[model samples]
Target: MLVTALTKLLNIRIPIIQGGMQWVGLPQLAAAVSNSGGLGILTALTQPDPNALRLAIRETRKLTPKPFGVNITLLPTINPPDYEGYARAALEEGVMIFETAGNNPAHLVKSFKDHGCIVIHKCTNIRHAKSAARLGVDVLSIDGFECAGHGGEEDIGGLVLLAKAAQELDIPYIASGGIATGRGLAAALALGAAGANIGTRFLCTVESPIHQSIKDKIVASKEQDTVHIFRTLRNTARVYRNTVSEQVIALESLPGGARFDELRDLVSGQRGRRVFETGDPDYGIWSAGVALGLINDCPTCEELLRRMEREAEEAIKGMAELVQG
Candidate 1:
């Protein structure tokens, strides 16, 4: 049993955390992962309203009694939903864990703590990790440049990023981005991370709500199949190299290309959500990390976690023997 601070604090058997992908993170997927002994996360913003989120939380409970978390991403939107309302709804549903991302939740940190909820903030750099640590968050999920969603402007990968986090932060952190296989999990632990936060890998799981065709596309893809966009707008994101993403990247390279309005239609979340429903990878920009290349099959969450645990033990043992020999 590979126990860590994250697994102990979250009361889960494994330290693997399912990344809260918008539109992809539903009750079914979250519950399956939780039932498999890993920490699952339901995306709060995916619900239409706070009441809907409350219902979703209840739905997840019906599926699995294991502990799970809810992600409250505070990204900039034209008219953002009531974040406090969603948080309250989660609290009402007896949720004790929160995975906050996109923007600093300095305002909501205390409220979460008052309710005895453990907040795990996601950051892309050591600086942000330090800031979140100061806010009294229970843990940090340090994302690297290879992460699907907002990877920040920095280009550091997990190898260096996790090492830097180990050197600087006082709090325990999970390594995210480009993480899929058991070898990656072992590497993260060796780098001082308490767990691994996986996003794209879960998208191809049997319990995932995304269409089968989308899962197939991910399995067929290589690491180079992903491309970065929105850099000029200062909100970088890594996504699959589909037609829409390619177009957006090409537009960004033009002389008059530094504005969001120019590519708003091509990269809207609504369009990406449609792709998930329709099984069309070319429909819009969907978030995907470089780990898509590492996935070759659509295993059930239970199967995937079990395989990962076995592989992790073998890899660690191999390293130990190497040193002893």
Candidate 2:
């Protein structure tokens, strides 16, 4: 019942959002979220071509009539990923929600707006959220320091980040980062967020396409098991402390600084694809949030949502009872 502008814009039953993970957030995962009453977003960069994206979209429609979205990140241009084409592909696929991170997104807002897509820009700072609101995005995803990928230079936590966004922006915002359970959902609402957008929790769901070994790791991992990378580039991503991630961090910290391209082989998309596709954790990039400690099982999307709603509601009620006492 906690409907926001985003829920209305995307016609989803719940204000919750499932983030777009590179290898994990495909049509199957996205549709599962949508059908389970949350807004599921497809990671457009995962698709090799526009045709593949279109096919994926079609496949999702077959699974669920509920709404879903497409995520197109604005990268730092170290690689030659065609961002605009991804946006265009989403539009051609009749995407309802167009989410962009890592850029100003003014042009994306205009283009997607013209094509009748609801733009939800991910922001890590109040100024960024204000800018996105001014650009006419329908919703803002307020990412905090606890977020999995690139929490930005500000380092605002979800609480302060949402307060700032709520103070300045007219559009509704979803609190990202550090949110894992129903109690976290209640906390987000208390922090001035209309809803929550979760990544790590959804990643471990049964409907998610990632390998069981990966899900098991997330379920068993503790908060300390995660670490950050690329913080120097303001593109910091939180990933599990696996062998490959450890090596990457070690190489980055070396004194006589090596070239960025030297480690370029470390961050290869091909390497990531192979690892995520196969169950090979030794050589893969498993980006996740510290909330991995909180998740303990791989439930279906419906079961997860039900459990979250129950836990969140009960937590809020308990708090209310405490006040009454």
Candidate 3:
């Protein structure tokens, strides 16, 4: 059994975390990951309201008795959802862990701690990781530029990013972006990460709510099959390379750069949801990480976790044999 600060703290059998993906972090997937001994996260904002989130949390509980988390992403939305209400609902429903992303979590970190919940804040760079650590967050999920969704504008990949975090941060961290296999888990531990946070790879799993065609596309994709959009607006997001994403890039490159309003209809969340629901790859833009290159099959969560455990052990043992002493 692979154990680390994350495993011990979260009380999970393995040091793997399923990323709280929007339109995808439903109870079925979350419970499956947790049942497989990794921490599964439900996206709080995916629910329509605080009450819906409460129901989702309860539903997840029905599926697995293991510990799971709620992801409350704080993005700059003109009409933001009731963030506080969502937090209260999760707390009321007995969620003991949280994965926060997209903005400074100074406002909620203290409250979560007060409720005896562990806060795992996601950051894109060492600077932000340090800032989150200063806020007394229990753990950091340091995301690299290769990550899906908003990877920050800094564009740092996991190799240098994880090493830099290890060198600078005193708090435990989980490596995010481009991680798919047991070798990746072993490498994260080698770089001083308490665990690894996987997104794209988990999306291709059998229990994932996304359509099979999308999962199949992920399995067939290469490392370069993703493109970065919204860079011109200073809010870059990594997503699967598709006709729609390409169109956004082309528009963003024009003259003074395209405004968000111009790309709104094309990148609408509803449209992205359709792609997942309808099994269409180019229906809309969908988040995908560079790890898509490494994923080869759609295995059940249990099957995937077991395989990862075997692979991680073999990789770790093989590395130990290289020691000169």
Candidate 4:
């Protein structure tokens, strides 16, 4: 039973958190993680609308009575889904935990805190973390350059970012990006994080909603198998090194950089969703972190969580013995 501020705050036995991945964070995976004593998150916008989100929340509740969160990512889409509607739906469904990412959550933070909800905002750098802290976000999930999806443009990895966060931040934060194993969990604690947020590793779990082939590819991939795309557009995203992602990189390398309109068809979220639905890896670009190299097998959520707990304890104990004092 590894206890920390995150565990106490979320009322979970373990400090690990399952990242709210789009097209992946569903009832099955979220409930699995929560049942394993870690915080699980359902992607709110993954549902078609607020009504659908309510149903998904209800479905997750049926799977596990344990606490779970809803992830509402705020991005600048041409025709965005109803963000407030999703939040309200989650609140109406009695979900008190939220994981917000992309854009400042100023518009919704007050309402969430006022309703006694704990908001965990994901940030790529210290500047964004501090800004979110000032906005009254309960906790921060600090992402590194090795993270999947949008990793921001700073390109700072978790090692230096987590250490810098420990020195400067006043609020409790969890380390995100490139963390898959128990040793990674222990390292996050050593760096002053309340816990760790895992995305890519969780995606490769037995219970993950993705296709088996996708999981297999992740298991076989190395740390360098991921490519950082959209850097020329300023909204950098780390994705699996697939044919489509490589094509996007090529287009971005064109003179004056590629515009969002040119890459829109290739990077469409629907296309990426198909990759998960089907077993075709080259169908579209999918988000994957450097932690893919650390994942060797697809175990059940329960098996993974228990193993991580044991390994983290062993790692901490072994490190204590190394001290000369």
Candidate 5:
């Protein structure tokens, strides 16, 4: 199968781009996915400082010589005493691709562009995608409301959003949200997308940094299992309906403590860090997509990417044969 504009821009073989996840998109996970032919994104603020980010980048480089990038989410967060410091580290480390989420990345964009880097900004809605496109980002990762982490409160599905993007913007945009299989890939292409970006399905894989217990929960989940929380503040995020998430939702409704950090203690950095590092699920409540239902096994990244490509090719060929007949 041919690579999408993202893969071509990132110089990777697979069109799949590992969503930059905080607490999950570690250097190990980034290297695994990139070396497997997909673009792995290292969460910029994943570490405490640029030194740690640099260390993670170096460690990932030690593991694989493939292309990778750093994800800078311009949202409210603690770490990153100096965001530019992390960006500078990424640049100094020779990180060629940069993926950003939330707000205008103009300063970072100009800097990264000056350094010969291709930028991809994840957007939850068409307006954001358009803004990113205007910022001259190399790619637009259209994260519909179905994706994990912070998704827009917008009710538009990828089916509707992709077409809306195609109608408004002429830039290369990829479809995300509820994508798991080759069929989703094919559907994305048919909807005028160059490729598909998968998160929840990828999280269930062995190469992911999330705990196996969380993966099990995702495996057991269905398309309707996820719910949107924090919508009242426009900081809405799609979270797996866990006991903790339920509490978070309940509290948000009553206005006791609705900040993202309220559950921060329940799922503390120390606790979450250990869970992801040790594969202990009970220690934390991680993010997941509704597409979890489509994931079944924890295969290696190479195996998953290769199989997806092969299956996509076969499915398309089979459809071609039918049309020919």
Candidate 6:
């Protein structure tokens, strides 16, 4: 009943989006969220190859017939995978929704649009959001500095970021970063966002592929438990406060500072992936937002979305009463 542009656009029952988390956005989790009436997204790059991505898409389809999407983040890596190959695989599988992020997404936007796929580009600032809008993306997922991964160096929080994007962009945008609860969803709607793009909260869900220990850590965390690292490298990422993340911060804090190469081993994506399977938070640097502190329990995707929808309705009704009082 909390219908909005996002719900209409994505053809979902609610306007909640499970942010495409790397490694964690597996078929099981994505299918659960989609089956629960929210837009679940699979991280396309999680697959080892394009053929593997197609298999993952097929697996997700087997789990749920609801609308879901694939996230193809275009970030800088020393050995980047074939992004075009992944996109082509998804397109061939009849995927019509895509969530793109990192670096300039104009090329991917044009490609997805040409194939008639709805592209939702994630941006950390209004400038990027506007640029993506002009690039013909269908929607913008506006992430603020509170976001977990690659929050950019702007230091803007979701409040100002969402409102500014609403004021500036013609394309409807979702408010991301530090968004978790029903109150958060209601706030995003009040701030002129079509919905809330949630990452950390979804990581704590039962369907999330992360280790149970990691989910427990997120549940026990506080809002201030996260720290931003790699600002010196201009590839800032907000992660849970752990020994490894702290170590990265310390190295970056040195007088001369450490280069990305020096920190590469400790922050490698492979190590981080292993952490999800091995139940070791300090195994490597992983992406987690300040919203982890907001998570207190691990609910099934169906239960979580339903509760959020109820909470949003109550919040909206409360606001209406205040206005009519």
* TM-score (all chains, Cα) for each model: 0.99, 0.94, 0.99, 0.98, 0.91, 0.98
How many residue pairs collide in each prediction? 0, 0, 0, 0, 0, 0
- Residue range 1-325, candidate 6, lDDT tens digits: 9889999999999898899999988999999999999999999888899999999999999999999999999878777889999999999999999999998877778889999889998998998888888899988999988888888888999988888887788889998998889998999999999998899999999999999999998888898888888888888889878889999999999998899988989888899998899999889888888887679899999999999999999999999898752
**What are the root-mean-square deviations of the candidates from the true structure over C-alphas?**
0.9, 1.8, 0.8, 0.8, 2.4, 1.0
User: Model 5 over residues 229-266: C-alpha lDDT tens digits?
Assistant: 66756777786666666766777787455666565676
lDDT of 1 by residue, 184-287 (tens): 89999999999999999999999999999999999999999998899888888898899999999999999967588889999998999999999999999999
Q: Point out where model 5 deviates above 4 Å.
A: 77-81, 255-283, 322-325
TM-score: the better of candidates 4 and 5: 4
lDDT of 3 by residue, 53-111 (tens): 99999999999999999999998989888999999999999999999998888988988
Q: Score residue 134 of candidate 6 by CA lDDT.
A: 88
Clashing pairs in model 5, backbone N/Cα/C closer than 3 A: none
Off by over 4 Å in 1: none
In model 4, the runs with Cα more than 4 Å from the true position are: none
Clash pairs, candidate 2, are: none
Q: TM-score for model 3?
A: 0.99
Candidate 3 or 1, higher lDDT: 3
> Which regions in candidate 3 have their CA more than 4 angstroms from the true location?
none
Indicate the TM-score of model 2. 0.94
Clashes of 5: 0
In candidate 2, stretches whose alpha carbon ends up further than 4 angstroms from where it belongs are 322-325
